[model samples]
Target: MNIVRKLALSASMVALCCTAASAANLTVGFSQIGSESGWRAAETSVTKQEAEKRGVTLKFADAQQKQENQIKALRGFIAQGVDAILVAPVVATGWEEVLKEAKEAKIPVVLLDRGVDAPQDLYLTSVASDQVKEGRVAGEWLAKTVGSKDCRVVELQGTVGSTPAINRKKGFEEAIASSKNISIVRSQTGDFTRSKGKEVMEGFLKAENGGKNICAMYAHNDDMAVGAIQAIKDAGLKPGTDILVVSIDAVPDIFAAMMKGEANATVELTPNMAGPAFDALDAYLKSGKQPAKFIITESKLYTPADDPKGEYERRKGLGY
Candidate 1:
């Protein structure tokens, strides 16, 4: 090879080696909340992909939707002395002690997709969407769609204490406060699972005069929405037509439902929360630059008019 070509090749090889070495030098621990829903599963898949793309050595732990399990996992990561820790908290409380341990260990903890009730100084930064805004979007759409019509809505809430559940419910309530016609007649927690969603929705359908009294169903996530759709069908009621369906988390299945005209609206909660989490970690580790206490993600509303078929195609391979 010519001398110039040899130099270029050597430089390329050096850059590649340096990149690999950099990634190898840092180890990150990810404590996921288990595959509680399609959205959560998609987040896990996307997180692993992001870590792989960055060449990061990712240590994973599935907490199975238990706060105690998550705490134990965090302790395990701390004992392992991983470079950093990423957590999708199952609940908002009871994290301060473990986080304090992480703080003492000097391992920066980054909360992904959810937040804890602990003090801000306990972690590095949180990367999540404005969950309340997501609810507001859903509520606003419902309000506008059924303007001046008395609408008795039923809500499928997420896990009781999780930040998304709390914030999303609060936001939806706030949005519909001005609309006297819209009221949440019955609300129940689905624990953010499809099976539980279906079970609770069945009860709601039975309670609300065989689902005739209900004007709409709003879920905290798409998985629950899909479950509710099945329940509505079992009651011999058309989902999107008989009872308007709106929810958060634009999972691919929800798009499929929308395509089938079984669901009405959904708000997008991007599952790639790890992308920004990694970005903040890289910046903080390299330059001691602190990312904002909260790294807010973007959310958008989706409906049948937005082309559900295309959306389903786009997200189907993302493990949703």
Candidate 2:
């Protein structure tokens, strides 16, 4: 071959090799539930950041809060033959079939921030906070703050059948079970939205003598707590003062509320689920090491006494 032709051929071969190497880098598909709240949005942002940090190509899909949409996304990910899949399921019970498909394709699936009711063999691992523990922490904080006072607590629950809603309710109930002085006088679903939470709290206030009878409020999440705080103010009552406010998911807005003394306490559900998930995936893929089926994240509690403003500042840029 001529020298010029050989040089051109070598350059083309190098370009092709580089392209193939880039393509061979780990590619993961992430099927996220829609940004239903600030926490969810933060999770999505953090997942993308984590993928970028690890040089993994991420194929993201938003399910818009629908199980059918999530199922469809999972199928598409399977068809794409991704190296792995991460899903923060919108609900738990309807994941068996899609998960089975992933399992059959030999793709390791990880559940992020939520879990499924499917067989453990279907997914590599689930990375999430202990929902019950989160609720229990909030309840325990409320109980300790009240300190034997007869407290009539109203609960603003999450979406009715969500695993977080159910487990958090159970944990709070368990925490306050021994405290006869602390009772949940009114418990209703808020659908995990601010508007619904405000609506539900308004009803609770009207039913309980215009918020005078309620001593405190326990929301399944901070978004609901923030909404209920507004409801308390509209009803001519102070939230942190008249009715001690406590909830889970320490999103930035809740920290702002705490800074304003509108919220008393919250349990943090960190949006760093993807960090742990990617770690596990890397370990498994690199060494064939099997991770535990359930990988529980930290459930940290935050009170107003904590640096609320600092917390808010720290989480503000996370797209919350």
Steric collisions counted per model: 0, 0
TM-score of 1: 0.76
Q: What lDDT would candidate 1 get against the real structure?
A: 0.89
> What lDDT tens digits, residue by residue, belong to model 2 across residues 179-210?
99999999999999899999999999999999
lDDT winner? 1
How accurate locally, in lDDT, is each candidate? Answer: 0.89, 0.88
What candidate 1 gets wrong by more than 4 Å, as runs, is: 1-26, 63-82, 90-106, 117-119, 158-166, 188-213, 318-320
Q: How close is every model to the real structure, measured as TM-score?
A: 0.76, 0.82
The candidate scoring highest on TM-score is 2
> How big is the positional error of residue 175 in model 1, measured in Å on the Cα after superposition?
0.8
